[model samples]
Target: STYRLLSLVLVEGARVQPHYIADTSRRSTLLELRTMHHIRQAVAALSPEGAARIAPTRIVSVHDIAPAPEITARRNRLTRRAYLGGQYDWLARFAAQFDIPALELCIHVDDKAHAFISEHVEQVEGEYWQLRKELVDTDLSLFRYFRFPVLHLTKLEMDRLARQHGFHEIMQKTWFCHSPWRGRPCGICNPCVYTAEEGMAHRLRPLARLSYTLLPVLSVVREARRFVRRVVKR
Candidate 1:
């Protein structure tokens, strides 16, 4: 399945341009194609296991040249759609062209942002539950428009799923790796700090621990940088 999917991508590249094809003898995975210079290098890195699975093929570099203002505007709109959960259609189209099944690997759960805020707010203030409820409703609405099969799992549930998918040990070890502190999770931010703490408190899964460790620090740094830039602009 992986080989066929890659072949189709390569074929698409051929249709786009003839000279785009480069030998991919070293590349291990399709992700290496993201870098133009690494195309051949990545193809060279492919393991025997990967080679036996897929055919050795030349890859093409699909470069986007600067266009006129109207073309740029259209490209921006298309890019936005591609980012905001609209890439599924693109994938479907690609799959149809290659006669392959377009499988969606969905990871659905509660919004970490709301969950984190709820934990920090005073329970007596009644804002925590209200915000949490709103997030739940928002997530429900978001899922209604999702066309793929979504595996709705809590932080803990996701761990179980990861283990089932043969990444149990990796998931467990990486959980705490993202923490701001060595042993304790940061109790702020949406994904890393907040989700980490909650998952740990509830023994959600070892896989989810790292986000608590690392994400808060990164988010804080980014927010601070943004604030500084805004103040400078003012």
Candidate 2:
């Protein structure tokens, strides 16, 4: 039950391009994909047919959708609400491309992140919570298969469930760093910092991870690297 639907999404956008079409021929092959196996395991529970074809999601980027070209573009940062909008747009495109009869968009943002979403509107400068409840309430028709079934669980609890599904070893193999050092988790980015905070990566040091989360300069550099990687195919 614990492993029912935990939310820890660190899938490589490149892997599920439908073009790659995973050759899940053996366990060792799946292990090479690291954390994606956890997702595959979950999808298997929902619909075995969908799980079999994991390579259909390409060009997946998290952002906002604005009327202006600049705001909608990846160059500008999206407001929390716009970010959700962009996600919806992406799914629409995904379904169109893959000819998917239907798709289930599972959103399991962490408790730490959820602490920021609020519909009441924040006049404060430094706020982190605000879900675009108003927008979602209006045009419900846009989301044909968007499902956030596990907002009740925290990142820690969800991750624990992930490991519970006989994926403890593979979970460790999962990569989160956008700018991995020689193809390994930088272990200092925001996600990696959370990973350490939740006691997910024992190999990462306590002080270093905390320091990385606090340093704005390092955050920018890492985010830039991720942005570049997402736009350009290397």
Candidate 3:
């Protein structure tokens, strides 16, 4: 029922903004609706016990929740406006739909801090550190309305969190093996690097294998671009 409702809303949203929906690599709103319908049908075919065991007791939607208003009103806020807007809608709908409480899982990785190699590095000097610090200090109100737990998880902790969210490491490994570079998972991007590192640490060998194979390909493409630029100058 939740899936059906969400599909209807997504379809409506897409109808309202077809061009905006069409521009992204994510499934077209129509396709998403179809996919959800297919999933629901498959689940419905399962035995009651099987369905109950597999189905989430509480519907969970993980998002990057925004900081509190006090934090957002201040200077150097890292949370974007869209983050806040999405949180509002997600929370409102979640409250309305579920008879039992829904869990608004907010996952925050300290991206700016993660970007810095070391404190002494010029790339992450005073301003960068200060900005990251401000972001870290900001109050995130994820716990206010739902069962929110702040996890300052390292790469390893993130894997544990994923498992807690019903994704087994083996399943995750299989997913990475099959569709390793889908969408923005550019094999050379920071996210790819981090994912690779985490998977290896957790002994998700398949994910590590995919990352190793693709990262070199991405690096070669990047180098080829640099070479092309240099040649074009002549």
Task: Name the candidate that leads on lDDT.
Answer: 2
Q: 1-234 in candidate 1: lDDT tens per residue? A: 111122323322221111222223423223223333333233335332322333344343222222234333433454453333232233323333333333222333443322223332223232111222344333222222222222234556656654554433433333221223334333443334434444644433343444435555778998999999999999
Between candidates 1 and 2, name the one with more favorable lDDT.
2
Instruction: Quantify how close model 2 is to the true structure by its C-alpha RMSD in Å.
Output: 11.5
- On TM-score, the leading prediction is 2
TM-score of 2: 0.44
Off by over 4 Å in 1: 1-99, 110-152, 158-221, 231-234
Please list the residue runs of candidate 2 whose C-alpha ends up more than 4 Å from where it truly belongs after superposition: 1-102, 109-145, 197-234
Tens digits of lDDT, candidate 3, 1-234: 222122222222211101011212332333434444454354345323323333332324333233344433422232342223333333533433442343323232433322221231222322121122323333332222332222233545555644554333322322222222432233434434555665543333455556566777878998999999999999
Put down candidate 2 lDDT per residue, 50-102, tens digits, no spaces: 45545533332223212333223421232344434343444544444455542
TM-score of each: 0.30, 0.44, 0.34
Order of quality (TM-score)? 2, 3, 1
Q: Which ten-residue region of model 3 has the weakest summed lDDT? A: 14-23
Cα displacement (Å) at residue 142, model 2: 6.9
